[model samples]
Target: MQAEGGLRERKKRETRAALAEAALRLALEKGPDHVTVEEIAEAADVSVRTFFNYFPHKEHAILGRNPEHLERALERMRTAPPEESPLTTMWFIVHDVLRDLENEGELSRRGELIMGSPNLLYQLMMASFDDERQLTAALAARMGEPESAVRPALIVSTAGAACRVAMELHKNAPGRPVRELVDEGFQLLAQGIDPAFGPNQSNQKGHS
Candidate 1:
């Protein structure tokens, strides 16, 4: 029974991956707005009804892939040694996953495609925000703290900002690992940039 269950789970994962890959390929060839669910289903070699069974909308087919990595990172953070600081654990998990993606050569083309289309970028941002919420909740639970704790929110925002900056940096330095950008961003945070400064020296220096 255990072996059969594992096989079934693996098959389901493969089916979902096929659907997502098909959607992305079609969206790349012909802009995301032009791709239809039926076309995605055909490309994935599944019936349209089967596609709906896996995803509620065509956008879900493309955006759902983001959650898989986020979930895995969250699980890693949750299972890290109890002695690890929350920030350190979260950063470690996120950096490891992003580094692996960088090593796999999966970022350049997808990053360009996502950055080129405002609609797709907006969808991706929404998905990323959802990931932030989930990770925040999981981290709070793991740390035995109230879910409304400010620390979790700060952690999520910091991590999200780091990822956004990393993506922008990747556009210019495609050869550099994203972990470097993330590390640099965290270092800036650690150096005590005044929160009231609005990320500018004028605000920090009280010029206006």
Candidate 2:
């Protein structure tokens, strides 16, 4: 029964991936507004009901924000060694997630899709805000602090900003590994985001 259940879960994940990939391909071919859940389902060889089961709307399908992926990352963060700082644990979790995204060109395609659609870009920002809020609450729980505390909110929001900047940089430098960019972003954070120091001191001073 356990094996059977695992197989079923695997199949569900495959179906979800298929639907998301189909949605992105369609969006790329014929803009996000022109695509429909029914068309995506048809392309993925699933019914519209199945598409709805995986994603609430077409925008979500294109965005490809799987709740399972988020839960998996949260689980990793929750189970990290007690001695590890929350920020360190966050980098570990993000590293694994970004590694997966860097596979099979899907991340690049999704980035292109977002850049092409203003509405999709807006929706993606809103979704990111939701993710930030969720991570803030999770970080609070991990720290055994009240959810209303300001520290967790600041940490998670700052981390989100770092990730966003890394993503933008990665989009420009497509040949470089995204993990390296992310690491550089975190390292800069660790050194404080001041312009007076670091390898780009001259550049930073000029900007200042």
Q: Candidates' TM-scores? A: 0.81, 0.86
What is candidate 1's local distance difference test score? 0.78
Evaluate all candidate structures by whole-model CA lDDT and list the values in order: 0.78, 0.82
> After superposition on all CA atoms, what RMSD does each candidate show versus the true structure?
3.5, 4.9
Model 2 ranges with Cα > 4 A deviation = 195-208
Q: How far does residue 65 in candidate 2 sit from its true spot (Å)?
A: 1.6
| Candidate 1 per-residue C-alpha lDDT over 64-164 given as tens digits, one digit per residue, 9 for 90 to 100 | 46445776887786788989877777678777767655564556666667777788788778877888788888888987878899988788778778878
Each candidate's clash count: 0, 0
Q: Model 1 off-target regions past 4 Å?
A: 64-67, 99-105, 193-208
